[model samples]
Every structure is written in structure tokens, then in C-alpha cells.
Target: MKIAFYGSSLLSSYWNGAATYYRGILGELARHGHEITFYEPDAFDRQQHRDIDPPDWCRSVVYPATEEAMRSVLAEAGAADIVVKANGVGVFDRELLEGVIAQARPGALKIFWDVDAAATLDEMRADPAHPVRAALPDLDMVLTYGGGPPVVDAYRAFGAKLCEPVYNALDPATHHPVAPDAAFTADLAFLGNRLPDREARVEEFFLRPAASLPERRFLIGGNGWDSKPMPGNVRHLGHVYTHQHNAFNCTPLAVLNVARDSMANVGFSPATRVFEAAGAAACLITDAWEGIEQFLTPDTEVLVARDGQDVADHLAALTPERARAIGQAALARVKAQHTYALRGVQVDALLRAQMKGANA
Candidate 1:
């Protein structure tokens, strides 16, 4: 099928998780014989940070991100078998959304792929300025990345024709265990950008643990952490690229996961790192969150940490052999169920359903 993916930067991860998401899904879709044209709005230096170019796999169409570009793209978008518009394109996205709805062919599928369902819903509920408030019923379908039970029901309640959660999964080719890089090797590591809402949880789940275990080396990766002071043992690497993630995962004795406020509140939302770390055979020590058990069984596949003491205890109790065993078990689970290929199959099913409904 000829698919047109309209989204934010395809290359930059700057404050957005959608970039990694697009690379994984669209890259795998290309491998599956689906033709893809990815549109990127030239808002940031996406071309500079691009890890993968528009090889034989995809046609990359970058627009000027203005109203004129929106008009031009909507004309071309009408021809696609499927067209996807996700959140945060840095353009006049409301007008762009209107344009797409106005210009799409009757048979061409239109989907809103949300990387931030929780935040989007919250914004809509809180204020009147939100663009998606009355536009819920306009899109053909709503697709999300990480919100679990609550998000699906809420989107349906908000008048969506269909709402599906395409949770983050590991790309098998990219995220397997590798030998440790000396710099990333650590007793424990946490990687995520700093946000005001997630700060307290980071303190409760990460910083406090570092303070408790002063002798152990802890690494932190992600941008915007420079202002935060840390214990002497903690190493802050500003941002680790997608290519560096496997070593970052495999080299840690146990990787720590702390969710942002929306994810924690919505429940069952696992970040891409969770799957990546699992695929790299890294034993995970994650902060206690609802719906976590659905992904991994506690005390066997993963260690659950509700507080700093729990995190410290997890580290103290680990033996290298036991850690490797847990990592392997987690990795096995991801390979069996959560690979990108599995996700693509689900997406293809949804698209077929939309096409079927369109015909009927």
C-alpha cells in the first residue's frame, strides 16, 4: 500500500518521543513491502540529526511548514491509500488538520497517531484553546503509542470512531545485548529528559537511590538535566542516540524506569526504553506503576521499586549471574511478543478494517 505519514521531525528526539517511534514503525513497514512517504515539517534541524536517510526504503518530503505547504501537501495527500497525521508538527497544525480533512479522498484513510494521549486529553479537558476539542469525530481513527486501558476508553468516549494503543516495542535488529561500553557501564542507570512533573518521581525513584548507595556508579542520560545537582557517584550523559541505546541498556547492572506524570497517571504505559532495555537483556528495576504486571512479572522478570529503599535493595541483592538470568528472561518475552513486526501486523489489520468499512 502507498502510505503517507505526516508527523513532526523524523530525526530529532529533542523533547519528543515521536521521532524514535516513527523511525521504528515506518522503517519496519518499509521492510514489509509497504511503500511509505514520510513528511517532515522543517521546524527544527531534523536534517542535521538524521540517523537514517531516505534510502530505497522511503520517500522523504520535507515541507516549509507554512499554510501554503499545507495546501500543497493536502492536494498530494488525497492520492495516498493511507495518510497519517500525528501530533506536534510545529506548523499551523489546526489549519493543516482542517486541510487534510477537506482534501482527503473518500477512500483514503486518515488517522491521528497520538504519541501523547494523556497530555492531549488533559489539554482538551482543561482549556478551550486546544485544537482537538471538537475535532475528535473528524478523523477516521485515533492511534496511540503508550496509554493503556484508560486512554482507549476515554478516546472512545470522546467520540473517536476507533481508538487503538500501539504500545512501544523493541526493534529486534537494533536492540539486542552487546558488550559494555566502558563509559556507559554502571551499577544503575536512568535515561529520560527532565520535566517538572516527572522531577519529584525522579528524585524519589533515582536521586534518592543514588544518595543511598554512594559507592555505586549510577548513570543518567537525556537532555535538560544539567541544572540538577547529583551525588558524586552519578554520571550524567546529556543524551544518548538511538544507536548508543543498546550499550546503555546492556552495560547497566540494572536499568531504572521512571514514568512521566501522564504515563504514571494513565497506567500500563511502558516507554520504548523499557522494551529496548528488555531486548538488550538488561535486568530492569522500574518504579512501581499501575498495569506493570501485564508486561513483566515482578520478582522474576523484573524488580519493582516503589521507593528509594526498594531501588537500593534491588542493587544490593543482585549478583552478576542472577542479573543476566533476569535480563535473558525479559529479553525472551519481548522477542516472543513485542517486536516491531508484531506491532506492524496489528496496524495493518486496523488499516484493512478501515478500508473495509470505507467500502461498505
Candidate 2:
């Protein structure tokens, strides 16, 4: 099948979390004999900070940050078997949503892939005229990164004909454990782009734990954190690139997963970090969230924490051997059920089913 995807930067993860997710799933789809064209805006710092060259499996089209440029790109995308307008494209999302739907051929699948479903839903509920909500009925399907029953039901209630989650999963080729890098070594580490919605949680789950254990080394990676103040023991490495994720995860004695408020409330949503950290075979201590166990078994494959005290206690309790055992179990779980190859097959089946239903 020929697929056209419009999303945040595909060549840079600078401020985009969807880069790895796009790379993993789309790359695997290519391996399964699907042709893909990914359209990304040349905006923000992504173009300047690009960390990856265009993949052989994709035609990575970069257009100028203008309405005319996007319209031209969408015109081209409209002819594919599937045309996707993903969340957080970083510019003119409302226009793109309308353009993709308008230009898509009648037989082509016009999809709105919401990488941040919880947040997207909130926006629609807050304002009925939000482009996604307006486009819901016309969309062939709505795909989400996270959200299981509740998310699907919400989309249905909002008038979507179909909704499915293509959850984040491991790309072994990209995220498997690598030798630890000295620069990233720490007792605990977290890699997340600092966003307003997650900063308070980061403080509660990460900063407070650091304060509680002054002697332990804690590392924080990702951009937008350099301006924040931190405890003396915490190391802030601004903007860790995609190539560095494996080493970053491996170097930490244990990594932490703190979900943003929206994702936490949505339950079943697991961020890409969950799979990445697990793929690195790193012991993971995550903040409590509903439906977490469905992804990774708590107290066995992962450790769950309700507060800073819980985080500190878990860190103190895990001996190296115990931590290693947990990491291995988590890694095994992701490898078995959550690799991108598996996800690609699932996506292909869904698309085929949708196509069959369309014909019938």
C-alpha cells in the first residue's frame, strides 16, 4: 500500500516525541512492502537540529513553513492509499486536517492519528469547533498512540466511525540495550522533553526523589530543562538525541517513567519511553497510573510509585542483582509482544480489514 503521513519532524526529535514512533512503525511497514511518504514541516528548530537522514523506506518531504507549501504537499498526499494527519505537526494542524480530508480520494483512507489522544479529546470537549472534532465524522478512522476502551468510546461518542490504538512499541533495531555511556551514568535517570503538563509531575516524581537522596546521582535528559533549577546531585543533559537513547537508558541503574496528567488519566496509555527503557533492559520505576500492569507487570517487570517516598524507597531497596532481574523481565515482555514488527503487522491487518469493510 502507498501511505502518506503528515506529522511532526521525521528527521529530528528535537522537540518531537513522535519521531521514534513514526520511524519505528513506518520503517517496519516499509519492510512489510508498503510504500510510505512522510511529510513534515520545516519549522521550529527541527530542521536545524536534524539527527537522522531520510530513511530508504520513506520519501521524507520537508516543506517550507507556509500554507501554500502544505497545500501542495497535501495535494500530492491525497492520491495515496492512506493519508494521515497526525497530532502535533507543530503548525497549521487545523488547516492540514481540513486539507487532507478534502483532498483524499474517495477510496483512500483519511485518518487522524492522535499521538496525544487525551489532550486532543480535551481540546475538542473544551471547544466544539476544534478541527479534529469537526473532522471526526469524515475521518475513515481515528488512531491513537495510547488509550484503550475509554479513548475509543470517547471518539465514538464524538462521532468517529472507527477508532483504534496503535500503541507505542519497541523497535529492537533502534532501542535494544547498548553499552553504558559514562556521561549518562546515574543511579536514576529520566529522558523527556520538558513540557508544562509534565513538569510538575517531574518535580514530584523526579526532583523530590533527588532531594530525598542527596548522595545518589540522578540524570535528566531532553530539551527545555536547561533553564530549570535542580538539586546539586541532579545532572541535566539538555536534548539527548535519538541515537543516544539506548546508551542513556542503559547507563542508568534504573530509569523513571512519569506520565503527563492527561495520559495518566487516560489509563492504558504508555509513553514511548516505557517501551524504550524496557527495550534497553533497564530497571524501570514508574509513577502509578491506571492500566499500567497491562503493559508491564508491576513489582515484577516494573516498580510502581505513588510518591517521592515510594520512588526513594524503591531505589534504596533494589540491589544490582534484583534490578537486573527486573530489567530482564521487562525486556523479555516487550520483545515478545510489543516490538514494532508486531505493531506493523497489526496495523496492516487493521488497514486490510478497513479496506474490506469499505468494499463490502
Candidate 3:
């Protein structure tokens, strides 16, 4: 099957958080003999800050941020077996959706892959006439990054015919345990773009923890944080590249996973960092989110922090041996059941079922 993915920059992680998810899932799909065409916009400085070249397995199409360019790109996307217009494409998302669904082959599956379903659902809930709500009934499928049952149910409530979670998973081929790097050496570290929805959580879970443990060294990697009033004990490494993630994860004694407000409220939503940290065999301490146990068992596979105090306590209580043990257990769990190979199988089943229904 040929899949057309229209999302954020595939060659850069600069401010595109979904880059890792796209690389893992689409690469696996390609490896399984499916063709993929990734269409990303040439905006957001992603081209200037690219960390990777286009992969050979899939065709990478970078179009300009203009209606004329998008019209042509959407036409090309429509030819595929499945056309996905993912959230946060950093372009004219509503316009692209209207164009893609209008132009796609009658037999082709037109999907809205909500890499951030929490925000999407919230928008639709607040405004019934939101563009996504209007598009839901026409879409063949609505796939989410996470939010489990609540997310699926919410989409259905908004007139979605089919909703499912295509959650983030570890890509052992891309992320794994690596030798620690001196530059990123820290007691606790976090890597995420500082978006409004997530900044409060980051402060509560990460910055507060660092403030409480003033003696401990902390590292923050990602853009939009350099200008913030960060703790003196915390080091901010602006815009860490995708290729350097393993080293970033490995160098920290324990890595932090701070959920955005929407994701945390929705529960069961694990960001890409959760899997990447586990894949790299780093001791993971995350802010409390419901349904997290379904992915990684709390207190065993991962440490759960309810607040800054919990984070401080977890950091203080963690010994080298215990941290190593947790990292190992987390790694074992993800590699066994949460790899992209497993996700590819799920996607294949979905495509087959959709194709069958189309034929019917």
C-alpha cells in the first residue's frame, strides 16, 4: 500500500515534536514493503535546522507554504492508497484537509491523524463548528497519538465514524542505550519544545524539582526555553538534534517526561520522549498521568511523580543500581511489545479493513 503523510518537517526535529513518531512508524511501514510519501511544509525554519537527510525508503516532498504549492501537493497526495493530514503540520491545516479530502481517490482512505488529539478534541468540544468537527464525519478514520478510551470516545461524540489510537512506540533501530556524553551529563534532564500548553507542566514537574534539589545538575534540551527564567542549577541546551537523542537520554541519571495540560488531563497519553527515554535505557520519572500503567508499570518500569515533591523524592531516593534496574525493565517492556514493528502490524490491519469496507 502507498501511504501519503502530510505532517511536520520529516528532516528536522527543531520544533517538530512529531518527527520521531513519523520516522519510526513510516520507516517500519516502508520496511514491510509499503511505499510512503511524506509531504511537509518548508516553514518553521525546519529546512534551515534540518538534522537528517531524506530517507531512501520513502519519498520526501517539501512544499512551500502557499495555496498554489499545496494544491499541487494535495493532488499528488490524493493518488496514494491512504492520505493522512496530521495535526500540527505547521501550515494551512484546514485548507489542506479540505483540499486533500476533495481530491483523494474515491478508494483511498482519507484520515486525520491527530498527533495531538487532546488539543484537537478540546477545540472541537469548545466549538462545535470547528473545522475538525466538520471534517470528522467525512474522514474514513481518525487516529490519535494517545488518550486511549477517552480520546476514541470523544472523537466518536464529535461525529467521527471511526477513531483509533496509533500511539507512540519505541523504535529500537533509531533509539537505544548509548554511551553517556559529557556535554549532556546531568542528574535529571528533559527534552521538549516549550509550548504554552506544556510550559506549566514543565515548570511543575521539572523546574520546581530542580529548584527543590538545588545541588543537583539538570539539563533542558529544546527550543523556546532559552529566553525563559530557568533555574540556575538547570542548563538549557537549545534545539538538540534528533540524532543526539540517545546521548541526551543516556547522559542523564534520570530523564523526565512532563505531560502537557491536555494530555495529562486526558490520561493514557505518552509522548515520544517516554518511549525514547525508555528505549535509551534511562531511568524514567514522569508526571502522574492516568492509563500510564497500561504502557509502563509505575514504581517498577517507571517512576511516577505527582508533583514537584514527588519528583524530588524520586530523584533523592534513586540509587545507581535501582535506576539501572528500572531502565532495564522499561527497555525490556518497550522492546518486547511497544516497538514500531508492532505498530506497523496494527496499521496494516487497519488498512486492510478499510480497503475491505471500501470494496464492499
Which clashing pairs does model 2 show?
222-239
lDDT of 3 by residue, 310-353 (tens): 99999998998999999999999999989999998898888879
Tell me model 3's lDDT, rounded to 2 decimals: 0.90
lDDT of each: 0.83, 0.92, 0.90
lDDT for residue 69 in candidate 1, whole number 0-100: 81
The number of the candidate with the highest lDDT is: 2
**Per-residue lDDT of candidate 2, residues 98-124 (tens digit):** 999898888888899999999999998
For candidate 1, what is the lDDT?
0.83
User: Per-candidate TM vs. native?
Assistant: 0.94, 0.98, 0.98
lDDT of 1 at 58: 83
lDDT of 1 by residue, 295-316 (tens): 8878778889878899999899
Ranking by TM-score: 2, 3, 1
Where model 2 places Cα greater than 4 Å from the true spot, the runs are none
Better of 1 and 2 by TM-score: 2
* Total clashes in model 3, counting residue pairs 3 or more apart in sequence or in different chains: 0
Ranking by lDDT: 2, 3, 1
lDDT of 3 at 290: 93
Task: Look at candidate 2 and tell me the lDDT of residue 64.
Answer: 97
